[model samples]
Each structure stands twice: as structure tokens, then as C-alpha cells.
Target: MRHTVTMSPDSLWGLPQIRAVCLMAFAGISSFAVMLAALPVWGVGHAVPAHLAGTITTVMLAATVLTQVVSPALMRRFSLRGLLVWGLVLLGLPAPLYLWATALPGLYAVSAVRGVGFGLLTVTAALAIQVAAPPGRQGEAIGLFGLAGAIPTMIGAAIGAGLTLSGNFGWVCVIAATPLLGLAAARGVTADGTAPGGAGESLPMRIALRRLVVPVVLLFAATAAGGAVITVVPLELTGSARAALVLLVFGAVTAYARWRIGRFTDRRGHRLVPQTLTVIGAAGMAVAGWGFAAASVPLLLAGAIGTGIAYGALQSVTLDLAFSRVPAGQAPIASATWNAFFDAGTATGAAVFAAVAAGSAGGAGSMLVGTGLFLLVGLATVRSALAPWLERRRGPGRMEP
Candidate 1:
């Protein structure tokens, strides 16, 4: 197996394919992220009902999740290169159409199409990472890819929202078309989606999904917390500049932590990683929420740093663990499933957080506090109760519990 062969740490990055995937992933995700923040603002500015403003994002995410769920089946019919190139086209070519699609129906239609492209782009790119990275260095390679993805999302949102609010929707659309530039990168990646050996083909999808459920849930919760913080902070802060600064801090911390955690887990293993990060996330959420409520900049910034680190590390740790639990042949399925849950978690968090902010007097702050507490309780239940229950459920002949 390629993973069994030793390679230099830097060799993974040296591969032309790895660099291509990273650049394509960055450009593709940046396209999605920029518009994700802009569309809602555009809706609100265009006099879409306040209650329905967030539906723009929800609809797009719904399309994305649905596409991801069925991507494995799609992969059977399409090459990864075909998917990547077409996905970029589908995601990018529609940017200018937004100019004409100013109403709710038009916006949703365009978003849904772009969302499908996003779904195609994300799943294919993730699988490409598995295919492109050196066997032994998959963890670090995935981390680097995560860092590529994380940066654009954080900065893209800030830029998109800032630009849209300042009456530069046209510029936002132009920037959102960044995926168009990635077409060249897309062409450089491996076209085949087949796993190295056919061994993983024997593993049932049900079994692969069952083993992955724990990590998927963990990822979902962490993303929810992170998404809530990212979506709500701007609304709660009095000024755009402060909100942008907080977001920048959060993104920077997350990008760096994800990259480092990949290397750390590659060496030390991942048993304690998720639990520890969850605790950090809980505390970060509480502090940030309190800071928001009290209007303290320092506490808010501090909380963002902690939350970013926890969220970013968890992203790396959980993904590595998920891939570890599955056989190599089943990687595409794993990637699709993980990406689906990741998007679903973010969408759910954004919607739920926005609702709480709209309805509650304490608003986003209280929701953050409650989310933090929820994480703590969830951690306790998983460690004290769920782990043992799962252990007892595993049969003696089955793979290690």
C-alpha cells in the first residue's frame, strides 16, 4: 500500500497534483463562501421579508447537502476531472446571472444551481485529496487542504458582506466568480476516482456509515458552534470594523490550528483529541457569549481565538479519525458523507442561531451560552454513557471497538 511506504514530509506538497487540488479547493470554496454571506445581505437589502432573509442560505445549503448525499452514485458515472471542471463552471458562470435574478425566486433558483455545483466541487475535491496525497502523509495533506479551505471562507465572508453592504454587489459577483480561474487547476488533478485497491469495495456502506456516526456527530456539533459564532457576531457587534476584526482573528486561529493539529495527530494519534477540543470549545463559547453580552472587546476576541483553535483542530482530528475507521476503497463515500454533515451542521447552526437572535431578548449572546452548555453536556454523555454502550454493542469478531 502507498501509505506503508515511507516518504519525506515535504514530498506531499511537492506533488503537482496536491498543489492543484489545494488551489482548486481554495478557489471553489471561496466562490461558495463569498456568496454565502452576500446573498442574505442582498435579500435583506432588496426588501425580502426579515423572516425569510436567512432562507437564501438555507435553500443553498439544502441543495448542497442533498447533492453530497448522492455524490457517490454520481461518481460512478463521472470522472473526478469532469466533476471538478463542470462543477467550477456551474458554480462560477452563474455569478453574473445574479444581476438579473434580484427577486426571491430568481435568487433561490440561481443559488440552488450554484449549490449543486458547490456540492459537486466539495465532494470531488475531498476525494481528490485522498487520491493525490502521499499514502503516509494523508493526515498532513488533508490538513493543508483544510487550511486552504478555511482561509477563503473566513476572509471571503467578511469581504462579501462588507462589499455588499457598501453597495458593491457587482464586485462581489465578480469575486464570487473566482472559481472560473480554478479551471486550469482542476485540469491538473487525477481524473480517476477509484481507490488504490479494491479491498474497501467489500465493506458495506451501512457499516462504513455506522462506524463513522460518532465522528460525524462530533463534527456536526463543533461546526454548529463555530457557525453560530461566525454568523451571529456580526449581527451583535455595533460596528462592521469590529465584527470584521473578530472574524479575521477567528479565521486566522482556525487556519493555523487546523494545519498544526494535522501534524500533531499524525504523530501522537487522535484518541484524546476530540474530547479535549470540545472542552476548549465549550469554554470559548461561554466566554465569547459573555463578552458579547457585556460588550467587552477583549473577552470577545479571546473567545474567538479559543473557539477557532478548537473548531479548526476538531475539523482536522475528526476527519483523520473518520478516514482511519474506513478502508481505502470506501474513501469517496466517506468524503461525501463527511462533507454533507459538515454543510448541514453549518446551515442548521446559522438558521437556529439567527432565529434565537431574532426572538430572544438576550439574542445571539444567550444562544452562544446555551450552545456552550450543550457542548459540555454532550461531551459528558458521550464519554460517560455512549462510549460504553457502543462498546458492549460491538461483537467479539468484529473490527476493534
Candidate 2:
């Protein structure tokens, strides 16, 4: 027997558990978003080498990935509320430390510590959703969850970038402290002592990894592209409000697409959507690359909008797919694995794009253009290679599940 949550959208939104998780997610993600653009820009301003500054993100996300990998074990050893509380503490307490750690190595150290906290938040937050949501409503629940995360990105990235550029670092620290407010909501989360999927019915980690390659690849590619944009554009377009605007539009569009696509996928299914989004994202990267290389604000804004839609939609879809492919009890495994890919891809993009900008004459814009071409070619190759195998597996005319 399985549990089913059959409720209207309003009713679902009204659930105490849902409200608690959303508030917590909003606070945690806001802390992350505020620092995402600000830290790199701050590093560049304080005598850090341009190329090395991007590594701030790389270091943070590297820690995030490592923490996510070990989160399953952590969840088993601790209370969910305890972990969530500590994650918020670690994430918030370190922001003010940035004021003292002006050196590159010190900054990286702070980022790495913060990343650990973020890692705990990412997996635990998703697990909270898994436990709170009713059967058959996972997509909508994820959409709402995504919506909470997106608003902060939209508001925080632009604000952080803009503020840091204006030389207002203390304010950035203040905004980064927002995660502390989530402590109240964390207590209300419906956490039991057991890890999700601890029962014998769950699949082994190795098998789950094998079953999840498709969504993981799609998620990795999309996040890599988006992360490159977020990491490099601030450095490339310094001293101009245009950079902030570009980030603003990207965040706004991403929020709407991620939230809406959840319901759409629930009704229409997931078959063609991921491929279509990849195409759109690849194209957006190309346009934005041209915009960056050319320093055209309009083109940058246009590119941001296109990529934002694809990035947000792919996030929701990949997550929903990850949940759907696993045993119901195995949600924590899926959440941790998916989040690890998410941060790993972002870190890879930040490092690779920053290196490309440093090495290439055409800089960030050129890197974006090349990345777009790479994604396009990769997608086409993957489809060509997979179609034959799929046809043989499911018969010539069957739709993919």
C-alpha cells in the first residue's frame, strides 16, 4: 500500500509542512544567491586575480558536492531539524567572517565552509519535501519548492552584484544572514528520526545511480551553462548596471519557467520537454556569448531570458524525474544525488568558463559562444547514439517512458 495526497493546489499550498519547508528553502537559497555573484566580484575587487576569483565558486561548490555525497550518512546519524539548524548556522555565521578574510586563501576557506552548510541544506530541504508531499503531487510540490528558491536568486543575485560593485560589502553580509530566520520554520518541518528509504524496499545506491543517468546528464549540462553565465558575466561587465539587469532578467525568467513547468510536466508528461529545453538553453548561451563579447545590453538581456527559461524548466523536470524513477522511500538518495550533480555541474562551469575567459582573446563572450556550440553538438550526438538502442528496447514506435 502507498500513501496518496489528493488535494487542491490551494489546500496543498496551505499545508503547515509545505509552508514550513518553503520558508526554509527561501531563506537558505537567498543566502546562497546573495553571495553567488557578490563573492566573485568582491574577490576581483580586492586584488584577487581575475581568473582565480572564479575559483571561489569552484571551491564552494566542491565542498557542497562533497557534503552532499556524505549527507545520507549524516541524515542517518542526526535529527533532520538538528542538521537543518546547523546548516543554517554554518551558512550564516561565516558570512560576517568574510570581512576579516580579505586574502584569497582565506576567502576560499570561508567559501568552502559555507559550502558544507549549503550541502546539508540542499539534500535535507529536498528530503523534507519528499516526506511532506502526497503521492501523485510530487511535480507540483517540486514546482512550489522551486518557486521559493527562484525568487531569492532573482532578487539576491542582482542585489548582491549591484551592491558589491557599489562597494557595500557589509550590507551583503547582512543579507547573507537571512538563513538564520529559517530556524523557526525548520522546527516545524515534519522530520522523523529515520532516513528516507531506510526500509528494505529501497534500491541500492549503485543501482539508483545507474537508473538516473539520463536526468543527471541533462541537469549537469544545463547547470553548467547557467553557472558559467552567473560566474563570469559580473567580471566581464563590471562598473555597468547592465550586468545587474542581465542577472535580474535571468533570475526572473528562470523563476517563472521553473514554477510553471512543474504543473505542465505533471499534465503533459516529460518525454520531449527535456530535449526542447536543451536546444533552447544552447541557443541562449550562444546569443549571450555574442552579447558579452559585443557588450550589447539588449542582446545580453535577450540571451538571459532564453537561458533562464530553459535552466529553470530543466531543474524542475530533472528533479521530478529523479523522484519518479526511484522507489518512494528512496527520495533522500535521489535528492542528494541530484543535488550533487547540480553543484558539480555549476562548479565545473564556473571553473571552465573562467579559465576560458582568462585564456581566450575574446574572453567571457567567446567562452559562452563556444559552450553553446558544444552543448548543441553533444545533444545531437547523444540523441543519435541513443535512438537506435531505445527503438530496439521498446519497439520502433513506442513513446519513451
Candidate 3:
């Protein structure tokens, strides 16, 4: 059998396909980050109910999931650039809608439209690099791709959301829309969704999904906590200015950890990575909840820093492990599955916490609940990661756990 050689993480940057993926991922993620920070404020400011406000994200992310499930077929039908252009259009054109979208249904409509665009951009951009990378280097290549996209989001989320805290939704939308417009104008990327090895004779989606469950669920839990923070922490923190900083800390730490920990995963293999991430996540959640309950900004900031690191590491490591579990030619399936778990987890977390926030202790109770969930999930993932290692120690002939 012929084998494809892997590119070292540093060497991988030289490839056009990977570069294009990074460029697009940066544009897409930055756009989403700004809007994500701004829109919930917009909804609540205009007197939309908190529960209804949360549903906006739910609809948007749900739309993302719906689009991603069918995205592989869409990629085959259109040029990757063509699809990306549309995704950018969908992402950008609706910016001004937020200005006029006062009614609940109108806001949800705009969010849903934007969500489809995000779904397309994310699915295509992420898988593009996965297909582009050579063998063995898949984990590093994806990690770097994630790192490149995250830096802009870290900076932009703080600045954009900080401005939005003062009711500057219009400019945030403008900022969100501008980059994609420039990219589309440049027309630098013009390619279709062609895969290496032809990705020949695709496996049925149902079977592929079944193979992806374990990694996907762990991802779901981690993202659930992250989604909780993104959705609630901003609204619940002492004030929007300070609250915005919490988001800043979250994004900054997340970006740094993804960059640093990813290379470690590539070099060391995935052995303890997932379990370690869960532990870090649980600790962060515990501290964050403690801060929330006590109304301590310092502890809150520290918690955000810790959770941010875990969130970043969780994202890169989980996806890296997901790819490891799949067949070489099934990059699209892996991308779709990874994306779904993330979006779905985010939507679920947001809605769940939003429901709880309307209660007596405000969002502090929600934070405590989130801490418990993280601890349980961390323990569960550690056990899952060790099960196979324990089995190996017992010998290959052993089947029972």
C-alpha cells in the first residue's frame, strides 16, 4: 500500500490549501465572535425576554447543525470558493438586519440566516485543511489551523463586545461584515472541495456518525460548559465593562492554550490529553462558580483564564482525537461530526442556563450547576480514556473491561 508522508506543523504553512483554510477560518470565526458577543445584548436591550434571547442562539446554532449535516453534498455540488462566498454573504449581508430586527421573530430570522452561512463557512473551511494535510500530520495541521483562527477572535471578542456593552451594535456588525467582504473582493481563493485519494466511494453517513459518538459526546460536554459561559457570563457578571473583560480573558487564554497544547498533542500522541483537558475544565468551572456565587471579580477573572485554557485545549484535542479514530479518506465526515457536536453543545448549554438565570440567585445558581456538570464530565472522560489502557495492560486477548 502507498502511504502519504505527513508535513511537520511548521512546514505545513507553506501549502496554499492550508493557508486558504486558515484565512477563511479567521474571517469566519472573527465574524461569528463579534456577532456572538453583541447580539444577545441587542436582544435584551430592546426588551426581548431573556428566555427568548437565549433562543436566538439556539435557532442560529440549530440552523448551523442543519446545514452542516448536508454540507458534504453541497461541497460536491459547488466550488469551495463559491460555497464560501455564499457563506460570507449570508454571514455579512444580514449585519444591518440587527438594526431593524426589533421584534422577537425578526431577530430569530436574522440569526437563523446567519447561522446557515456560518455552518457552510465552518464546515468547508475546517475540512479543507484536513483534506489538504498529508498523513500523520493531520493533528498538528488542524491544531495550527485552529490556533491561527483563534487569535483574531480573542482580540476581536473583547474590543467588539466591549463596544457593544455601550450599545454600539451597528459598528460591531460592520466590523463583523468587513473582512469577509474584503476576502470575497480579493477573490484569492477559488477552488472546489476535492479531497486527497479522491475520498473514494463515501461511506454511508449513518455508519460514519455511529463510529463518532464517543469523541462527539465528550466534546458536547466540554462545549456545554463553554457555551454556558459565553451565553450567560457576559449578561450576569457585575457590569458589562467588567463582564466584557471576562470574555476577553476567556478568549485570550483559550487562544494561547490551543497554540501551546496542540503541539504537545502532536508530539506525545493523544494518550492523556482529553482527560487532562477535562480536569482543567472542571477546576475552572468550580472556581468560576465560586466567584459567581461570592461576587468576586478577581476570582471570576482567574476562573475565566483557567476555563479559557481548557476550552481551547478541549477543542483542539477532542477534534484531533476524533480524526485519529476515523479512516483517512473520511475527513468531511469527521469535520461535519465535530462541528455538529460543538454547535449543538453550545445551543443546549445556552438555552439550559438561560432558563435557569431567571431564578432567585440570578445566574450564580446556573454557575454552580455548570460546575457540577463539569466535574461529572471530567471524571467520566478520565475513566473513558483509561479503559483501553487498562485493557491493554490486561493483554490483547481480553475483551471484558
Candidate 4:
């Protein structure tokens, strides 16, 4: 007989396991928020050159990618609760260090320390959620889990921007404290050793690579578009207020779309929803770029919303696709690998788009290039290149169990 796991709404609140997952999610995500909040402030405060800001971001993302590779092994050795709490402390306590970071060396040190913490927190939280979630509802649980990070990305950027406007270094410290809130939440929850059952068993790297290709490619495309906008939009607008508004709109739409897409994927499958969103996103980027070139505020806003929606949908859907194909025990590794792709895409997008926009043709030319890439990704999905391969590997008629 198959086991049936039912989780009540109130049960989620009362159960230590469920509560633990929520806490970790909140803590991990808040750490991410602090990082986003810190970047621009650090860039301006130290009078770092604009060309260097992208490199700084790349260093942090590179750290994340490296750490994510080893996260599964780390989780296997340490309890989830232990890893999360320690990671939170490492993430939170580094704020004071940032206050002292007046030089590039100091900033680099801070990035390395914080990057490790963020990387561990991300992987641990996802593992906790997957283990805590009752079977058959993993998709919804992961979706909700994702919001801890998504919501903050929107809020943190705005708050970070606001704090910067105050012309105070103290606000950066305050923002750094934000991750502690998650630590408090994590303290109330318990760790489960059984969460990652059978995870340490060796698997072929080739198999893992083949399974991850589709989601990684999709991630690359989405982040490239997002990266292009993030790099070029501000320069094109030439007004802090307008640039901030664009980011704010992008964050809000992305957050809502993430929540809705989670449920949609849980009911449907990952393949179709994301493919459709990619096409829409390409169009949105095209419109937004055109608007940026024409200086049309309304068109820019429309494009921002579309891009946000598409990003939100794609983020969760890609994770779902990975988890659906792998063993339940491998969720953490799967989640980490997926995030590494996201970070890589973001890093590449920032660097490449900035270079492209620096040319005589400017931001408009860069957007056009980004739009073409997104559309190509969309076409690949429509051709069923990834879906059929994944379906065949798992065999027919096997849905998430």
C-alpha cells in the first residue's frame, strides 16, 4: 500500500518539522536579500569604479557556484538545522565587517564569507522543505518555500535603494541584520536526518548532466534577459527614481507570478507552462527595449511587468522539472545545481550586456540581442527537445509521486 501524507494548514504552523522548513526558508532568503541590498551601497560607498562593480558581483556569484557543488556532501554530514543556523550566523554577523570594508581587499573578504553562508543556506533550506513537505504536495511546498527568497528580492532592492538615499553607512548594517530574523525563525524548528534518504549513493555525472541540461538552459536564457535589463535599464533611464521604479515593478510582478506558477506547475507539468512564458518574455523584452530607446515610460512599465511575470514562472518551473526527474532524496543537490545556473547566467548577463550596451548603438542594441536569445530558447522548448528526452529517461506515465 502507498503511504498518504496529509498536511493541514494549522498543522504546518504547529508541527516542528514544518515550522523548521518555513524558518529555514525565511532565514536563507533574507540572507540573499541582504546581499542584493549591499551590492550597490558597497559600490558607491567605496567610490569603486562602475566597471569593477560587475566584477565584484561576479566574485560573489562565483563563490556561490563553487559552494553549491559541495552542498550535498555538507548536508549529509551536518544536520539540516545545524547547517542552517550556522550559515545564518555567518551570513548575519558579517555586516559589521562591511562597515570596515573601505578597500577592495576588504570587500572581497566580505563577499567570500557572505557568499559561503548564502550558498549553504540556500541548499539547506531547500532540503529541509523537500523533506518536511508531505508527499504529493512537494510542488506547492517548494513553491511556497521559494517565496521566502522571491519576496525579499523585491523588498530588499527597494529598501536598499532607500537606505542608500539616506547617505548613511548605518543603514547597510541594519540591512545586514535582516538575515537574523530568519535565524530566529529557524531556532523554533527541528532537523530531520531522514530528509535526504539515499542521497549519498553515487550516480553517474553524465546522467546528472543530461537531466539538468534543459532547466539550466532555460535558467541561462531567463537570467540573460533579466541581466540585460538590470545592466542597461538604469543607464538608459538616467534617473534614479525611474530606475528604482522599474526594479520595483519587476520584483512585484515576479513575486506574484512565482506563487501562482507553483500551483500551476503542481497541477500541470513543467514543460508547457515555462515554454509559453519564455515566448511571452521575449516579446516583453523587445517591447521594453523599444520603449527604453524611445523613452516611453508606459511601454517600459509594460515590458517590466511581462519580464517579471515570465521570470517568476520560469524560476519555480525549472526547479520543479529537476526534482520531478530525480529521486526525492536528491532535491537539495538538484536545487543547488539549478541556482548555480541562475547565478552564472546573471553574472554572464551583467558582464556581456554591459559590454554590448557600451557600444555606439547603446542599450537598444543590447536589448535586441537579449530578445533574440530569449526567443531562441523559447523555440527550443517548443520543439520539445528537452521534454521528450526527460520523459524518455523517466519512462512514460510517471508523474511526481
Model 1 residue 188 lDDT score: 72
CA displacement after TM-score superposition, residue 343 of candidate 2 (Å): 0.6
What is candidate 1's CA lDDT for residue 292? Answer: 74
TM-score list, all predictions: 0.90, 0.92, 0.90, 0.86
Judged by whole-model lDDT over C-alpha atoms, candidate 2 comes out at 0.80
Question: Superposing all C-alpha atoms, what RMSD in Å does each candidate have to the true structure?
Answer: 3.4, 3.2, 3.3, 3.8
List model 3 lDDT by residue over 1-401, tens digit each.
01234445367778777777687678777877777656776788889887766788888999999999988677767777777777877887786787898788998998899999989888877777677767777667777887876776686667666777787777887777854653643254556455333445555767667667767776787777777777777778647788788888888888877767666765666665666777777778778878888888888888888778778887877777666665666766787789999899888877787667656756677766767776677676676566666878787632111
Q: Is candidate 1 or candidate 3 better by TM-score?
A: 3
List, residue by residue over 1-401, the lDDT tens digit for candidate 1.
01223447465667877788889888988888777667766787787764566677777788988999888877767888888887788888898788788899999899898889989988888888877776567778889989988889778877777777678889889988999999988657766654343553447768888878767777887777776766666656646677777777888888898888877766655655677787788778788877877788888899888888877887877777777778877777788888888888778766676566656544445447545654764575355323434566784332321
| TM-score, predicted candidate 4 vs. hidden true structure | 0.86
Clashing pairs in 2: none
Mark the 10 consecutive residues where model 3 has the least summed lDDT. Answer: 1-10
lDDT score at residue 238, model 2, on the 0-100 scale: 64
- lDDT winner: 2
Give the best candidate by TM-score: 2
